[model samples]
Target chain A: MEIFDILLTASFWAAAVRIASPLIFATLGELICERAGVLNLGIEGIMVIGAFSGWMAVYLGAPLWAGVGVAMLAGMLFGLLHATLTVPFGLSQHVVGLGVTLLASAVAYFAYRLSLPEVTSPPKIVPFQPVEIPGLSQIPLIGPAFFNQTPLTYLAFVLIAVVSIVLYRTPLGLALRAAGENPASVEAQGLSVTAIRMGAVIVGSGLMAVGGAFLTMSAFSSFFFEMVNGRGWICIALVVFGAWRPGKAALGALLFAAFDALQVRLQQTPLGALVPYQVFLMVPYILSILALVLMSRRAEVPAALMVPFNKGER
Target chain B: MRLEPIPNPSALRSIGLPAGALVLTVIVASALALLAGANPFATLGLILKGAAGSKFALLETLNRATPLIFTGLAIAVAFRAKLWNIGAEAQLYAGAIVTALLGTGILPLPSALLIPVIALAAMLAGALILLGPVLLKTRLGVDEVVTTLLFNFIMLLFVSYLLEGPMKDPMGMGWPKSPALEKAARLPRIVDGLRLHWGFALALLSAVAVWVIQTRTTLGYEIRAVGLNAEAARFAGIPVGRVMVKTALLSGGLAALAGFSEVAGLKGNLTLDLSPGFGYTGIIVAMLALLNPLGVVVSAIFVAGVFVGADSMSRAAGVPTYIADILMATALLTMVLALKLTRTRIRWR
Candidate 1:
């Protein structure tokens, strides 16, 4: 139709892509972790840690890349703590993960408050700038949509591709998959199942942290309490919907992000104009339940998703 | 380390696991406190002083404990039936929504009648919220954890809608909260000026009621049996599905009481932040109590003391209130780990 109409549609899609980027990274990370037979329910907490660390890094003199680095490190530390609790200690994965989430949220809130003690107004940071590819910018709709995004968005797409290859195309991937499927069998073959799972957890947490950092450093510059909100849990649901596949999980994240973006855009529409905003806020959760119901039968989650592996067990 | 076969402990001895875990957690948590530039012993002293130091602080501690007792009992009852009810937070909100609706409405009744009716409405609201997951888990074989958790978000959104939409008071400025409940519908303060109200008594009474049902009643035995071993329980002619459904509903109802207490007893108005994660904290309480109803009261007060101490710690130590949250979480983590590590196996024929 008209140029303005085309621009509006493009802008909406762009916003959708931006919103979905962190989710895509986090879900893919969770997908890898789940495939390796660990349910990193601490994704929410790790994400919050990432959000805070990233914000702190940016608040200092660090660049956006530095913030991402710090976020990933923070995520790894959290993942290490979570893995130790559930893996060696054999504590309830759900309980430990939930605890981590609460602890991380508390840490983030306190850090934020400490950094901006005197300010009644919300603290702000400079968000990452979009980097446009030189030749790609010349293309029509595809150019703006794909090439013009923050570096993290580009990295997120690359990660999906990388994760897919690492999970299905390599010997390490095969061994990791086997470990998750039957730890006893893998252990008999002389592979350390605990080590493999711990590696997966750490890597997955790092990815989740990067996702959180993306939210703070790119999507939203300012950190608020509960900013990560329930996105981490949403990422867990995404892994289920994607059936623990990196590509599919990324798609699920994008779908959720698109719906979220549409909800925001629809707030300006006539139907949305009449409805209370909270109804739209419920869309992600409602869609998550619908996704679970529709996919439960077909979704082939890892057989030992939450089960603790004991080396001494036969 | 030498491999040795240690003597298997008696069941009575196994109960010491929680106590041992608490001591270990305190040690580890103390180390963390040192890293924060605070003395662990001093911090412990400060926490105790902050929680129980002043009359006002003690009253605040009781107020905090009031809702937690209900939530803890709610969690314990569900855990007894092997039902993991993570939606206590949502149920709490559901109860609060109903209490607000009924308490603010034009129901011409005496204060005595109005208050109990409003409380009952809250209980029903909370119970009704659990129906979906209970049905889904039993009928469709869906995981209650996912369904209950999802429903929590739905209920939260619903409450937000009510606060911003139909329940919004016209006389209020731009605050996103409902109109204050009628004076007749409010819970009477137990002591003249203290924030303590009849809800505290209700909390204590409910704790006793839960203990009676859990230990003395047949249903409680069935619930405990199902939790221990569902297949064996079913083989023993216990209605496992029915027990699950009932426990889930009861858990929601208990959690809802916390919401009722907040609205009618404390706030007299429904706000979005009515619960400061009371449902989640209830999980920690239930676990710490080892799922004992009476023990829930002790654990809840302990947890409430932490919250009160956290606020005071912020004021006294200049440490953020979140330090207390961190310490509490650390304690929970360590305690859970310790319990698992110290699991005493029983040799029985």
Candidate 2:
């Protein structure tokens, strides 16, 4: 089969959308947090907790949606840890973020081992199957790619649109942006910068946990150690590539997903047959670096990003 | 209550506060162990026994601490210059792959020459990997945190590929690992019949070397100046960018030594799971030391004890070994919080 013929298949697009959904959820979440001037290095840990909690809920016979709820709750608790450390205590953001990640991920692993220590194979759960919208999925490639997706994937798209609307067209979004840009100024308006920033972090973390839940509940059927992998880190990078915009971040997620799909497809081709499949795996990361190099020149980060907002001090 | 920062943070206070925090962290960790249906005292006893109860256990703990010291020092150096080299894991993996390749008979050299050459190659490969992030930050103002982190995933994938394809052990039963290094290229053991090796000595020596460089040299002063305030350092005629890049290179090079130590000192081979997140744990080590090079030695050993002890604890107590990780992370969090509290008085007015 020709390379173009292989690339143009509906299945490829469908796979791309499916693969990209987790990142979509995560990047959108990260974008919101970064836009509010908090760079959460705990994304990896939060994602791990999310994946673990979601898996645990399912393993305990809870429905998939309930698992997602548990994951979000876990993410919020972790986020609160971050906020308490970096905000009120005014400790280093990087250290607190790293600490939370280490703690959360270790706890996740411990819980998993404690719950299921003797499984020879990773215990599997009934993963969310893709919902085929009766009327919409009939439409060709677009339908299968967009309409025929898991409910989580559909939520991810809706989140993109909702986040876009919230960020660009709302007063609360304005407060978040101002808080990120100049917290002192936002505080001058009698709006508590700490509250706004903390809310952004918690909300963002919840979304990120949902993204993590999607991995165990919908994307894959089982939870393994380090199952979230580095998708959280990828989301962190995509936030920069997207320049803090939800739409752009979502698009970046898709671009990465496309690369992921292409790599898997490449493994089937004669060219890929000649090379180790890991070579294809390197493409997305290398591409992200290149993209960052090219785009970062013009990218504008939040002025207060990574800087802890001290309420009364300069 | 409001916190007021102390103008001059006392050394005793700094040390005392974090120590107290560590005690609290242990109490919290013990509570967690209790929640897990294990006797906290038994778990603690197992950890102590596993870590340093016997000579053999002590050697294993030392063996584990060696790599952490290298990576911790690597982090301390870069952090002193305010450069975030979060890609130490990638650098370590790169170095391990390079060191392994040199030992695989690919280079036609004498054993003595091959060992030194492999070390140099590892250092160079690790530095080169970090060169991108350093340059990006200095040139385009891109943040190194995300870039360095992203590179880690990329490098791990690269290492995974190498192990599966070019470096797969042929004689082994389909394990994705490189061929073991020549016996001549392996690090000599410091003690007979123990896993402890020359890497521990090297780690100790490097710590002293870093501490001396950090305190007793013009370059060290420059690095600290740049870290304290880059704008002031630049105004005071220091090349802030060059110092940042140089510090990053050194950090990467030292982190590479960790990979070398693991391969040459312990494993004698390269595998995908060569490091159980030692690179990231190094950050915790550095922070626990307050970014002090010499302090990294104690912190690395302490952290190593937690992990080593946890392993034995799990074996003996039927508790999950990850409690060690939880303990370390808790200590780190409390350490930073305690330090902050030390410098600030709570005003409950």
Candidate 3:
């Protein structure tokens, strides 16, 4: 069979959408946070915390929705810690973000080990299975890819539109953009820059935690050490690739997920015998770097991003 | 109450703040221990004893510290210039892979020549890994934080590929690691019958070397000016780009040295789990040392002691060793908090 024949299939597209669901959620979350002029590098750690919490909840016989709720709470709590450190205290964003990642992941790991020391194997929980939409599921090419997916995957797709609308059409969106571009100007307009940023981070982190919950509750059956596996960093890159736009970021996530799915499929073919799997795994990262280089000239990064805002200072 | 940044904090305050931060870290850690159903005081005592209980224990602490000091100095040198080299982990791996390739007698050279050659090759490999990010930042205006961080994932996967394939030890029982280094490539032990290697001395020397260069050199002045404000430094005739590149290269080289030390001093072979986030931990070490080169030695040792002690604590107290990681993270957070508190005047309005 031809390699192209194998690649162009409903199953491949379905896998891509499934894999890309988490990336979409993370990218959208990061997009919201960066639009408010704060770079939250703690996404990786937050996701790990979310995954652990969600898995533990399900293991303890809670409903899947409850597991997701607990994960969001965990993310919000960490987000609050980050905001307390960086927003109010004016601590370095990079330092606080990295510190939070370490702290959250450590706490999660400690909790996991302490709770289940005797479980020699990683404990399993019932995961989210795909649900097919009635009419759309019968379509030919894009049917299963778009219509058949886990509930979290559908939410992730819907959020793309939701985030785009919230970021473009709402008063809150205008304030968020202005805060990122010029906090002083926003403050002059009688809005609290810190409050807006804090809100952005909290909401953004909630979404990121949900993305993480998608990993344990939907994508995989159980939690493992470092299962977030640098996806958070990839999402951070995706935000840049998408030029801080929700629609563009979602597309970037899909593109990466497509490559990821292709790589997995490629590893099972005759071509896999010729090339190492690691080379294939590197496709998304290398492509992102190239894309960043190509787009850096035109990408409209928020001018005040990463700069600490002192409300009263000039 | 709120904080207002002071223009010039006093010398006494700088010294006092870190000590205060350490005390605060202990208190928080104790509170956490109490929650974990362990005696906080006993856990603290075990940590101290585990770190320096015996001659071998001290050596083990130093052994763990050897790589951290290198990575800490790596971060200090770069951060002094406000260049965040988050790819130290990748650069360390690069150095390790290169050193392993050279150390396994791929080149025909004398012991003295081969060891130095291995170190140099490792450093060059490490620096080259970071050089791409620096160039991308300078030319395309790419953010170094994300680019440097991405490189880490790439390098890790590359190393994993190597260990699993070409570099796998065939004679060993299915272990995914490179072949052990020859005696000539190994770093000599400092004391007889101890695991401590010459790498510890090298780490100390590098720290002092970094300190002198940072404080006493024209290049150091340029780097500092660039760090403070690149536009201002450029107006003053300093080549900000050149300083950034130089700082990046030195930072990468130092981080790579940490990888070289791990392979030559302790592991003697490149494994998948080599360094175990030593590069990331280096950031905390550098921060705890307030990004001062000289302070890195003390901070690395302290951080290393925490890790080693925690390992022993796990054995004795039935607590997971990762509790040490929590303490380190807490220490870093409190350190930053303390620095801010000390530098700011509190006011209630």
Candidate 4:
């Protein structure tokens, strides 16, 4: 009864929607990259770059949208590095991805410290305010959560539709799909698999950076160390859970955020008194593993996911 | 551009490329120093001075390298087998938790018997922690990378709970830390009144033992075969799944020793901040070492020295200590590319 009572609250759903925004953007980003046959393990660090750059930009007098753009650009630069190594040089994606994460995170932190030499705490910025759709906001239950949010959150929602369309409806989508599923087939079609895959990674990385920017420019309004904190990894899991489809991945992100929101709310109930808070915090990660086990069986990964393409190779 | 495999690369190719990468990394470092408005050569000198100019600085670098050597070996073993065991951080903490449980006045064995027992228990804990993901990977085809990474977050939360609850130190005033290890259970110092401990000796022994395992053991051959091509290894009558399980156990156990060494040797107690990303740093060490077990020791020392030196340099120069991390990342990327170039020739059309 208490669970039912809590589930009926609009604020809880709003919190869930807010939480899902970042995950949605990041999951779609990773899905795009994996679909193009490169596992951009640099998502974690790209998110860090986004968070720091977005927050710093707004703090330094740039508009909120400009901050998001700066974050995306920074993330794309790292993506270029990841693509250059893994795509043409045929380096190991795993090691290269981890290296990028380290590089991007250190860059953000080093730049932060250098730029703010005497400061003990990071400065705050005025983030994007939530904009409510008048009639939609008046609707019951789902109204406040879905129809009222900062511009970035709305952008995340819009991206889900855009990505699904681009992945399924466009000629570019077909080429991207061919690159991941069978690069040789793509080459036979006279399309360059290298360019398509690299472009996917660069664009996807930009989306991932936007996800991190969502945390700072909309959700938290401040940057902190480890703030990205495995969220990028979680989005990777979400991608698998959704079977690499943008729509399903977005839905998975929403479901994950709902559970996360429920866990936070549960801490205030009678159950919170009985269980350690850490148990609640561990739920999202533990659930990610369980979800992977449950869904991995049904997931059909791209055949050439981690395979490098050489034009003349068999 | 197209890549072609070299007919046979010269033996000197291995050393030359990585050395070139290091030079590039030095250029990157100088570039970073210029950005920070510090003298590049002066900053480099300060790092070297802080790392090994004094006996004390050298001792600190060794102490830092001790845990890294263990974790580096763990990563090297797992990576060579293609297990993608990124949960070394979680496994290390699992080992630390067990060390805390057994070494905090619980075990009644003498100094000689107690230390090994604690270490053994710690390794078992780490092995069992990784066993979950291994089982999942083998049984249901779950990706171990994500699972292992998620486990790190879960393990940290679990440790946080333990430190605040059952393992809380009574003498400490409301701090989240475990009770101190018994003096008899602690690893003895390598010298009289010196900062160095026997953990460094233990780490060196582990590196040598791992090198032997990789070169001289049947298990090592199976791991390499499985890594190179799992289907081929399976077709050759090697149990690919079993090899993976065994590799996980070995890798997880080695990683756990890092936690045991940190708890029972360096810190003498378990705290949340016991590892300053040493598990993650171990990956850099292993890659820098080119996944060679014996080379892990040298790379661990180098990585640890850079970190310690960078911290010292940050105070002297106006540069941030994070420059070392950037340096590490640059080194990893550049070296990996360099390693590839050793065996492959790039031709432009």
Candidate 5:
């Protein structure tokens, strides 16, 4: 292959990975939550809150890592709120999730506005620079495409493996899955279903918040309103598409990211020049529908995905 | 200790449920405002002043409420049939797109004929947009929530495409807006110089129409029965599937009116961000109304007041308009929790 062609292809792949980072993080988080029988619909809102908090922290002279920490703390707080409503209060999971999304969006918007008057130009936080592995950087096409990426991208890939191992290879994983599948049976076996589910929800929300923070800190230097957009919902779809498996969920994210990347690339192509840019933008959503239809016929969702579990219920 | 039986509750007690919920939401939202360093009472006073204190503000509030009332009713209608129609936002856009095309096209009709024709086009467009999800859900057992939500993105993109390409105004100087609708195709205003147009009346009529259908018709009974318990309705020989399909389509059509009203009655041109989450806000409106048709009108107006007030509050208090949204969400959450508390508890056993 020509050098120029190789460079173009490598850049495309790089963009794809960068786009997939947030999705991957969120999907893995959702996988854990779903495995424990709690459906965290507040993922989108949590991500938005994370983006704002992270941006605010970094914009105020805190380290970028500190932003991540603040984002995770915000996510944990939201997760606790959601857990209280759905788990203990036994409110509708779907309604509570929607409410949380609304509340989160409102908080982010207000916070952004409150800070707007003080700064003439929005403060730009430095993004995480690419860290190249010494020996891996010299490898073939894969080296530049995978190893020479931001720290968050590599963290996403590592998380997929870590989550997969934790979900399928450990006793805790078994107990969590059992809690979702049959909380009564799990409780009878001397496990605390509420505790397990709460842990999963908090962890999932924290991971999603980190994903949101990445959007503001790495992908875009300054946070815009609704920066997370619908990526959180996309993560929800990915969990279903991947059938609650971490590795498969990561693949789903990659697939979505690839399409999104292609859409962006197409905007520069001759064919894209003829059509409206909106059509290309719609490609991801259209593909999502097609994927949903295809998956619904074959994919078996968790047996107790949205159903609230009670301790004594058999 | 033995307890005596309680006395009969008054009418106020019954109405107090929703009223109390609304009050509680405001209190919580006010606390949040305090955290933001703004006085909740002062902020709310500004909102009230902006929404209803003056004629112009009231007109703006009505204009905002016009579409919300339609979308809220649309949501409530589908909810009554036990169908989760989250695609109202997309469906509204679909209606707006069709209305824009027809209203701006070279069809030379008088004002009387053009207006109705455009409105019908919007209704049909909305209904058509929702058909895919309706079919998938009723025939294939696909979840409408995901499909509807997904379609919202598609329709939004489609709208963006139209504005950027074929529908882009030639004289817009690179701005992404459609050409203004011909005067004949525009909705006439009832009052001069105010934003309030005939769409408010149309929305009112539609709300009444839905109320009549929901209360006086056999179809409404079937819908209510299905919503209460689908299997039981099916066992009772009610065609639950048909009711779901019809209700979903009706919901889409109603939501479409919101878009049509915005384009024909307000903007007179299609813009990219025509709705700032009006579709999503409709969900809160519907829930706050407890899915009651008449209640939807009152709830929609109240919500609209908040939005109008928020814009002014943002300007005056230097707070983000999103504080209004936070308040709205808090109100909705409280309302839902309160409703759940008042309902008969179900025992899984």
Candidate 6:
């Protein structure tokens, strides 16, 4: 059978969408942060904290969405730490973000060990299931792929519209974008650049946590170590690949996810027998680098990215 | 509030602020211990005892520190030039792969001669890995942080492929590990009958080497010039791009030496878990040391001691070992803040 035949299957597209859901949420989150002139490298560990706390909350008898809320709150708390240092304190975003990642990840592990001291295996919970839309489920392949997903997945799709609209059509969005591109201009307009950037990071981090919670609450039924597995970093690359635009970033997520899903399917075909599975796993990362190189020439990165802004100073 | 640079910071402000950061870290550590229902003082004591209270513990800490020193030096060298090479983890592994390949009965030489040849080869391999990302950054304007990070994932998968395929230890019972190094290829112990190897000695030598290079060379001046201001450095007739390329090779080679040392000196075989995020932790070490080459040695030992101490403390105290990681992260954050504060005064409007 031809390799292209795998792409025709409804199941393949379904897997692609399911995988893309988490990336969509995260890329959008990072997008928002970068749009506000802050690069939150804390995304990786924030996701881990989110995955653990969200699942831990659900395991302790909280409602599913409430578990997501717990995850978001946990992420925001870390985001607060990140913003306090990088935003107001005017510290290096790279160092502070890495520190937050380590701190958050360590907190998650410590919390996990303290919470469930006896469980040898990760306990399972009731994960989100496919909720089919009545009319769209009957359409062709795209319908089942896009419409019949968990509520979180649907929310992820909806957020792209929300973020794009708010970023483009709203005054708040203008100020936020101005903070990234020209903070002096933002300062001239009588808006607090720090507040805008901090709010963006905090809210954006909450969304990133939800993306992580999607992994445990929707993708898998249990939480485990390294389960997030650098997905957070991949989402960062997605932000660049999409040029920090919400709609384009989500598309980048989908494109990468499709390639990921394809690799999985490729591993089961005749080609699977010939090559090592590790090679296939390497493709997504290599492709991310390639995407960065391809789009970097035209990529409109936020001018004030990684630039610490101090009040009354350039 | 606004931060203004101080023309001359007093001695007390410099020392006191950094000391305050350490005190804050201790308080945080104690709080974490209390949360785990352990006696905070006892837990802290146990950590100290576990790290340096015994000769065995001290050696173990030194062993763990060997890799960190290399990676920390790697970061310090690159970061001093404002070149962010996050792929040190991958570069370290590249060095390890070279070590595994050359040391597994492939190279025919005396132990003394073979080690240097393998180290040089490993450094070259690691240097080449970083070269790609630096080139992409210089020419294509791709962000090296993301590209280097992406390279880490790619490199790990490549290592997994090798361990499971050509490098697989045939004598091992189906585990993914490389063949053991030949007796001639392994590093000799620093002292007879001691677990400590010559890698620790080599690390010290490298640190001093890096110190001399940074302080006494024209390349060093150019690196500092570029890091301070690229535009100014270019105007001063220093080749900014070429210096970055050279720095990349030096940094990547240093990071690769960690991998080489780990396989050839400590583990004697290459495995999937050769490093426990030594590359990432190196960032914390380098930052804590303020990117000083000599300071990297001190910070690497401190970071390694924390891990070793915390691991030992976990057995005695009800607290988890993650407290060490939290402490490290806290120290990194607080130290950077302290450093910033030392140079600048915060004034409230």
Candidate 2, B109: how far from true, in Å?
5.9
Decide which is better by lDDT, 2 or 3. Answer: 3
Model 4: per-residue lDDT, tens digit, B278-326?
A: 8899999999998999999999999999999999999999799999999
- Give all candidates' CA lDDT scores: 0.83, 0.87, 0.88, 0.93, 0.83, 0.93
Residue-level lDDT of model 1, residues B1-349, one tens digit each, is 1112237755654667666766776785576566566788887778888899999889889999999999999999997777878889999998998888889868899998988888888998899888788877777665667677778778878888887788997777978899999999999999898879999999999999999998899889889999999999999999989988888878999999999999999999999899988998998888888789899999899999988987777676655677767766777787787666456232321
**Regarding lDDT, does 3 or 6 come out ahead?**
6
Clashes (N, CA, C under 3 Å) per candidate:
0, 0, 0, 0, 0, 0
- Using DockQ as the measure, the top candidate is 4
Error of 5 at A312 (Å): 4.7
**For candidate 6, what is the interface RMSD?**
1.0
DockQ of each: 0.48, 0.73, 0.68, 0.93, 0.45, 0.84
Regions of candidate 2 where Cα sits further than 4 Å from its true position: B8-16, B105-114, B347-349
- Best first by DockQ, ranked: 4, 6, 2, 3, 1, 5
Interface RMSD of each: 2.9, 1.5, 1.6, 0.7, 4.8, 1.0
Model 3: residues with Cα > 4 Å off, grouped in runs: A1-3, B1-3, B8-17, B346-349
TM-score comparison, 5 vs 6, better candidate: 6
lDDT of 1 by residue, A126-226 (tens): 89889999999657776777788998899999998999999899988987888778888877888888888889989999999999988889998877777
Candidate 2 residue-wise lDDT, B197-249, digit = tens: 88899899989999998999998999999999999999999998898888988
Per-residue accuracy of model 6 over B246-283 as CA lDDT, tens digit each: 99999999999999999999999999999999899999
Model 1 chain B weakest lDDT span, ten residues long: B1-10
Angstrom error at residue B330, model 6: 0.7
